[model samples]
Target: MGNKSSSQPPMKWPQMPWTDRLLLSLVTRLRDVTCHHNGTVNRRLFPFLDHCTAANPNPVEGVCTSDITIDSSCNLYVRVFMPSDPSIQGRPIPVIVYFHGGGFSFFSSSSPPYDALCRRISREICAVVVSVDYRLAPEHKYPAAYDDGINVLRFLDSDRLGSIETVTDLQLDFGNCFLAGDSAGGNIVHHVARRWAASTRDWKKVQLAGAILLQPFFGGEERTESDIRLDGAPIISMERADWAWKSFLPEGANRNHEAAHVFDSIKAGIEEAFPPALVVVGGFDPLHDWQLRYYEALKEKGKEVRLVEYPDAIHAFYLFPKHNDNTKLMEEMKGFVQANRSI
Candidate 1:
């Protein structure tokens, strides 16, 4: 196990303002009531609430859907959001491959929260957004998701896969690519980045501009004090996370294996060859120190890295539209992607 400090303070969810509290209460009630009879809460509830909270009505236009198969049997469904105006100034628009967060066991690209966020990013950043629907776990195991991710990128870069398409009917330059994801999705991005760097095939030459990790889980074999303190934290608890990880891995597989835990596989090739990355974490999140450690690792390798910590936020806080912090985070993300587009 990695270093564990019992002296660290217990983690807590950030306090919400009255308005936000009321809104959250309403959402909780709706979710509870729906799940009471339905047996499961629909993941779309949160995104639907987000859409309602936003003053703008679907600012994104001309969204398209497609599927790219990673293997002969398994197919990955992808949802793409293109800028309303596809007329680029003869330059290739940057592309963001977004992976949805669901502990790698739940959710899909069709989920409302992912769909809305992808659309918003595509419009706001003036870039192409590709929301990947990789295979889920327990049914599929560790490295399965990672393999699917790498294959998706390969498919996009290959003409044989026929996965590439113009955004908003305008020519797209595949040269600029960004990888972004939340939770388990973040884990996928990290592993994919490492694999891409180590791959020897010509297909591995695709240029990656940057990567964005939102509350990523990077710890392997050890739990930080924050994880212990937030053992029963709302939404995502340490117990829940452990279960998710176990289910996502093959039966009897070691959790500490490099293929299972991204941080364990740290090597010179990964540290030096990875593109600049931005890691966003909530101060109250159990994974706070985990993300910080990842940032430190990147910096030690002399790679351009940025870390943004929201002092008064929680895991998945960015998905809530009613929170002002969410908007601020989005703005920062937009700026980062725009500034790094040329890289």
Candidate 2:
């Protein structure tokens, strides 16, 4: 260790199992041929890859789930997870608005992994979870996903939840609502929170209390130390990251665009009203430097932001239950929510 005060731990790259490797490789190839080349998702193959989960109106693990449309025209919706735990039934609980990570070009709120993750969050934290099924890129492209992310909040703010007995009766604490996401979803969380902050409104409900960004996908044209060292990262290799940016960012735009490089070049995005944040970073993630830059940039602007560094963990480590870091992450998130509960 460099110093007793340093939070940094020993560096260790996670060993990828052959099964995970095979799945990742297959998914990447499918996105290239079906989504990119064909200008639309392969109707037959993409669903197989997504392995989408359906909402169960009845309780599962003491949590009830249902799907609600945010925008039917664009196929935008949210899978709502409400804890049916008897003790917490009639009381207000923190609400977490979640965005899933797939480089912004893949995955959905209903993706099996995300469904499980959101359910765990709802049941463990005893909070309502709304996983946004934002439109994918290379088809919808830049700003489309961002717009959809914000729209979810707008939908919630409209008090539509009050109309649905399942959601309305849950008594979600709108004042304690939080934004949380990983990878590209993390990127969406940041942008959506910023947009919410910049708005001037006194809506009946829906106040952004805090944000949790896990390995937020942000980059620039210039390479950093982590970028060079983890070029061949286990899952989120630099090549895959580059491809993601190409698909999400506007055509002809480089990684230096404001959306891709939030911490630098355009410091204006960090608004004073932006909610307190907890940003998680993995040592083995190539985006490590970028995530750190975001934390520092927030500090420089006098914003409330905390950084959690898992030196031995790899990118997207929070998704898997086996990773020790994932358990730690959930603990940190729970503490953050309890501490940041807006009085």
Candidate 3:
């Protein structure tokens, strides 16, 4: 693991654009206040700043959302969303299991940005969406979030939702399921799908349709060209990205760990093991090369995949669903789902 010291030199946000400087200042303040010497995050202020929390009300119109506790023991939970589109009232639509991104240490299923995104997805696609609130790192660490993801799939396959009075009236077609996430959440989607594909354990009730990774967070010890090229890019600077990995990855695990580097999967033919995928890359984002490399590797492995690049966009564009780039992304997502959905 990289050094865990919190005494590193102060960030040089003044050199960045005013907007980017403000963004960096706000995030740094939050981290300074919530994070401890041991690297755990408190994050009580996130909901207020992001506009919601697990306890906050759902503000998106045309979508009905409810909370579910998949494992009471660990407080593992998820938020279920269904579109209010009357046309699809009794129709069984595809199910999308979504994971939100915050470098694996922050954010939740209820964070306003993701809430808005999921709301748009369910409303537009007329599908059932499950927003997972996976445990974060430093406190929960790697594999914990991955395990919660896998268990959610297990819960679905157990037919347990049939007993939940809240979701009983909803029509969810399990046979058409997809995994998706942005940044760190995208990393989770990859791992969860890998686990599902490699395991004999059956989630036979649901078919894994595809994976949609938007600006997936990946890293390695060997720095790539883009990492240096966009060293201090807005939202995700090289320093910030390195800190996130160091803070989240398991102790003693370096950037080259399979969990952080998707290329390791290629050796075992695991890229082929993954479901068909749509990988979205932001033109100016620091992680662009890593994301592109993963996409190219998948194609080389002969796995069905597509690449979409927003040449002028930056990281986490999907936070604003109405933005032109994000709108294109959502449309692409809907098309991918419709194409692969079980008939």
Candidate 4:
């Protein structure tokens, strides 16, 4: 945790319109009902949520969908979204392999927010968006999800494989690739980035444009003041986060493992030849301070980095298109991608 300042404003949710408030209440009710009966959500929720997203369409153009299988058994599925028109000609378009957030235990590729956001990013950034549906916890734990993430990238960058089910066949500009994720997915992106950095030969063939982390969860045993303050906030509570973390890690595995927390172990290596990074955090999120620390560490290494903090936002604010701040964040992301197009 970073040093606290008394001058920092207290974290709290800002006022919302009645309609938005009602929708949030309904979502909470539905989430509680589903969790109560099923214990946790299954992959089926993805298609259903996709339908919801399709109904409430956003201002995105060119939406193409396909699945990629990381493992041969076809158990693991990775969904992808590509722009209708080729955004980059003569070269493979820059690709963003996105990992969806659900504490690494909940949600699927079909979640409304995930589907809509993936489509929006594809259209907004004009890059192919690959959403990895890595195996979840209790049944499959740490390193499993991480391994699947690495394999997915390997498969996409492969030139030999004729075709693979569950994985897409889109031509990718492997040289200009970016790893991105939210929440637990953010943790996966960070892990993959470290691995990519270490495996220079493999990653060198492909340019790692940068990493975009949205409310990443870099875990540690000790709780920061922000975590203590936002212990029971709506959307993502501390208790839920704790449960998710425990569920993701294997039995008796230290939560602070280099592969688990990442920042501590890979900080030095990350500082050396790391790709540029953009980290976005909600001002009211418990992980805000941690994101700031990560940003500072990258800057200390003289790495190109950008940080955006939304003052009136909470965790997962970017997933909610209804929020004005969320819309602005999308625009900012588009500009960031445009300006940072890998050379």
Candidate 5:
């Protein structure tokens, strides 16, 4: 574990553009930015800000985006993006299964920001991006999202995905599939990857290549240095996180629940089956220590783990294009996918 002390050396934080600084200041004023009320989300109240975007199959410059239903029973769907970049068109492309972050209770895969992020990944990483639209909480609760995550994997391995028109013509390399998410979605990636590793289904075509977790939402019963010091910081706070946990976790479950605190309950054997992992940590994120803990836990279990740190980053810095770290992240991700892809 890294040092969890009160006093630390001064580290340079990223300089945000003026507009981003104003937006951050404004967001801090909200009780909880993503419409948390009465233990459930009220998307209607913030419809303008939290609006969804319809998927379009029509190619726009270098890529194409469309929606595919995964499971109608649970209202699960995914926004699929295929790269049309000249360099990638002729070759078989890797697939990335993405989950969006909204503290678990909010944000769908089709949310405008998430949609935009996936498009860039598809174009720059030269891979197909399947951003999963899992059910949310205070209603669906824990395991619902995790279950949805794994179900998407199953769908990819099955015959159904191949028949979809948007994906049919494109050469998708499922054998090199990677799971990625940020914040709460990052938490989901861990559980889903672990579950897939344990599944008895001997996958002959689909292989879990790598897990890309960006500042994964993780917690414990006790607070760490980042949690204590970064409290009330813009974007994320301890109070808001606690409420999210209360809303998402099963009734009466605390922060130490298996979903939130992964370091304690990990059993043997899963690590060997688990794919190589790349965990990204932001120096300014309150969850920094927890993300580090995740990397350390994986390393301790004899798993191949890579930790990428941005000393000047805040939580979800990848969302806004104004931050230079966001650009760096894309390049880092592009490199990871290229290096970890199946032969």
Candidate 6:
């Protein structure tokens, strides 16, 4: 959290509509009162917001979950969600290595929004969903989260997770693995898939079936029309997005770095080496243009891609379990995984 100085000008930006101004003002006041500045953000700043970390009863029926350490060296952990559906009762099931989003500086696998979302996805998709709690940035920095992602996949491809009794109960078919996430997590999904596709070391023994990116987080040196048009969009504003990039990237790195701008990696011509992808973008979100551009780029590269757009939705809407659009989003993801299972 940044310092809120009493002598500073009004926090509200110019040209903000009255309603938006009211909301942003309230949120800013809350942050000013509850959050404190440190070298890196400690998201547990607000007592009211601590619910995101507290233990909660599972919100989805017929699904079981457990937390396990993925890499002891880095203290990286993942929450494994498994379904009790009769169809996959005694057989190996598809695996989804899911990453949660908080602009790479907030949120965790145990957060309520992610807990409910992953649980629902496990039941709907009938697959083992490993929700990763990768290291956050302004501390761990760029490649740290990426390395944690690769390590989690490698753990899945091996028999290490099965050492836990609960995980052993649900057979995970690594051969049918898929990677997924929303926002920053979606960006990590892209990087993880690309690295695996381009690697020669064969670090992961299982085949990557596909990737599902829900409103992927992306930025560049130049602004797209949507970025300009939706400068102060709800949930993610241009300033907030810029802060995320600055906080997560290496100190001297610019937005054009391959890590910040995914198109650079795509243009490197790894299309034939990549797996099929499903991209979901919200129509009202600021990142909409970049999401669409990436989708078109994938199609132009001749890679199999499926894009689902919600023109009226807000960014990260699917993270809310009670949101009417969330179920539909989860269904679309399940269908995509099943449709591409043979790949």
Better of 4 and 5 by TM-score: 5
Best-matching candidate per TM-score:
5
TM-score of 2: 0.89
Better of 5 and 6 by TM-score: 5
Q: Return whichever of 2 and 3 wins on lDDT.
A: 2
**For every model shown, what is its TM-score relative to the native structure?**
0.80, 0.89, 0.87, 0.83, 0.91, 0.85
lDDT of 1 by residue, 5-59 (tens): 6686654567777765664455335434333231234545655443432212233
Please provide, for model 2 over 10-120, each residue's C-alpha lDDT reduced to its tens digit, 9 standing for 90 to 100: 445566656655655665565565554333445467766667788998888877888888889999998998888788766778889999998887778887778888998
Q: Which regions of candidate 2 fall more than 4 Å away from where they truly are?
A: 1-12, 15-43
Model 6, global lDDT: 0.77
Candidate 5: deviation at residue 85, Å? 1.7
**Candidate 5's C-alpha lDDT?**
0.82
Tens-digit lDDT string for candidate 4 (98-164): 9988777766676666887888888778787878888877468778888888877777667533453
Regions of candidate 5 where Cα sits further than 4 Å from its true position: 1-14, 22-38, 165-168, 267-269
Candidate 1: residue 24 Cα off by (Å): 7.0
TM-score of 5: 0.91
Q: Is 5 or 6 the stronger prediction by lDDT?
A: 5
Q: Write the per-residue lDDT of candidate 6 for residues 260-332, one digit (tens) a residue.
A: 7878667668746688999999877879998998898888888999999976666777754455576788789
Write the residue-wise lDDT of candidate 3 on 49-105 in tens digits: 556644323435788788889999988898888776677767788899999988888
> Relative to the unseen true structure, what is the C-alpha lDDT of residue 153 in candidate 1, on a scale of 0 to 100?
84
- In order of TM-score, best first, we have 5, 2, 3, 6, 4, 1
lDDT of 2: 0.81
How many clashes would you count in candidate 3? 0
What TM-score does prediction 1 earn? 0.80
| Local error of candidate 2 at residue 141 (angstroms) | 1.3
- Judged by whole-model lDDT over C-alpha atoms, candidate 3 comes out at 0.78
Per residue, candidate 5 scores C-alpha lDDT tens digits across 146-242 of 9999888888888787655346367788889999999999999999998888873666567888999999999987889898777746678787788
